[model samples]
Target: MSTKFPEIQGGGSLILAWQIKGKEVLVVAAGRIVNLLNADAKVTVVCPRNGLNEEVAYRVNNGQVKHVDRVFLPVDLEPEKKVAMVLTAIDDPDASTRIWKYCKQMKVPANIADVPSECDFYFGSVHRDGPLQIMVSTNGNGPRLAAAIRRQIGQMLPEGTGDSVKRVGQLRRKLRKVASGKTSRDISKRMAWMSEVCDKWSTDDFNDMDDEDMDKLVRYYESGEVPSFEEIRLGSRDHVVWEFDGTFGWM
Candidate 1:
């Protein structure tokens, strides 16, 4: 059976949770060590003994930094016991390659930060608006581009979008109960009818709905009867505009 992936919300939690599945992670880096701080697991930082900076070591609680002359992971550490491997030593191609090879041999999932070619996963840029979350991914091509796109989309969303989602959820539950035990054809017909009703929805309609208003709308759907307000509202909105054709006004 194929495994179904959940709708992932992009954030540090998602990345950290996936990496810390086994409660331990090995972070191999030479510099730029701050990125690994978010890993939820007990992290062991492996770096060049001579190349290790005091500041970097201090960030991971000093003693957590393992001083190794060369970038070589412990072969005896069972892959099943270790949840993940993160390589931030992207500048040294040879060391990164060796570490990646070792990770592959051990059957551990590895992420070579900023090096998409060597990475198995790509972190996405996320935008949050109340209960709504929008994530953008480049499939390892460009992360900054994804972030830029996320910002643009975030700007366009209305502030009341989260409230709209809640209202829609209520409508969905009511429809499901109304359509329960119906034939496939009958359900499809009801869905089509609801689609027409949705076409009539305005931003104001969503914004103004109270429990009583929602209950009335639900009754209209259950009975297959059009609401009287809809006819009057739609009919009163027509307007005529006049334009001048250079010298005279044309109707």
Candidate 2:
């Protein structure tokens, strides 16, 4: 048996969690699990055969998710490979269970399928646009509910939202680097400034072109010195929080 992985409490539920401010993530799963996760992790999907088709891999379009056509071996599995999390979807209960057992014994956070009792957390379905990503999670109990929520979200969000969001985030990241903290006024002012820009973004004929422009936005955000987990109203209307640490870097 593996060691214990710490569980995190969120929304009044205990789930498998990790706080990786800046850590490499390794995903050990097949198909959808590997394709879903993205961001800061060094993701590598462990599979026994060529489970993922090329077309499916192209959809995610991320450089991560390396493929190793090999079965899991206790001797070869590096439980301590600077990995933040592991997800197993081996299609076989016994195989997935075995992998989960090993990760547990090794003290790494992990999850398995068809065994909710043993899972700490299950991945959620998400919709992404520029800087906004809406997730529909059913706590592994109701896929039907998740799908229903996804439909509602699809109706709520307008098209081209993801592209707009990415532009904003790139800009914020740039601003953060040169911005100052400890000043409430700066933060407020910057937030307001961002709001203004975003509001007129579609009409101003302004769009992010290169790395420099994105960095400029990040630098501007830094001037506010905004902290992690920022909550801002969308289009100067509805409240939306954006923390999005690269925690779920790899699903």
Candidate 3:
């Protein structure tokens, strides 16, 4: 056996989290507006009222999203509006193709829903928990499979992982304030120290941390001293233990 995996081909999509907050996003239909709304995207749906799904209709009526109340137009991508992205889910194939072409001509990114060939980007199956988001992408091959994998991964993750991440983020902010200086080396050292702390601590350990515990960590950072995980971990809780059978099963 060669014991080496063969090189894969044809999927070279670059995955990224598109920042759309406060930016205009034109959605051609109602199939996938909920995720946009969740991301705080300034969405404008270009579809008749009868075309909207129940949730979308409620959102439009509540003024949560702007509604055009008609079919999509080329003018929707007018230069002055500076549309950040377009997502078209309309049933008309010709109209979808036209919208995709217009987006390309206008140099705007677009996702022609369920039409991967026309999409500039494909939405991944995302596992969201507070400040933490884990996205699984299959390069437009299998969205349902990606979602299934996401669910499996989600189950494997320890509970309170999101809270741990949030706490770590807060600690990083506080550490930055404490270690603030003009030196690039200082920033590098702070980042390295944080990395070490994360590697040493488990999710449960982070969940057990309080303001006092975090303050102690900051003090250690300020003093240019690194504390062992045992030294900083609270005594109130027992350390989390993991056991594995060394076998993986598909859902």
**Which lDDT values do the candidates have, in the order given?**
0.61, 0.58, 0.86
Q: If both were scored by lDDT, which would come out higher, candidate 1 or candidate 2?
A: 1
Model 1: runs farther than 4 Å from truth? 1-111, 138-142, 182-197, 222-251
- Cα lDDT tens digits for candidate 1, 108-187: 76777666667766567777654456768777667789899999998888768767767766776776776674788878
Query: Across residues 70-167, which tens digit of lDDT does each residue of candidate 3 receive?
Result: 89888899999989999988889998999999999999999998888999888899999888899999887788999999999999999999999999
Worst 10 residues of 1 by lDDT: 13-22
TM-score per candidate:
0.47, 0.57, 0.86
Give the total clashing residue pairs for model 1.
0
RMSD of each: 11.2, 14.3, 8.4
Clashing pairs in 3: none
Off by over 4 Å in 2: 1-29, 33-37, 50-64, 76-80, 170-179, 182-251
How big is the RMSD of model 3?
A: 8.4
Answer with 1 or 2, whichever has the higher TM-score.
2
**In candidate 2, what are the lDDT values of residues 1-251, reduced to their tens digit?**
55498676575344333344345444455544433444334566655445655743653346455666567666435645666666666667877788788878877667675587667666667665534656677777687888888889978765666666666676666555556554898777667767766664552123334574444335435344332212121222244555788887775
lDDT top scorer: 3
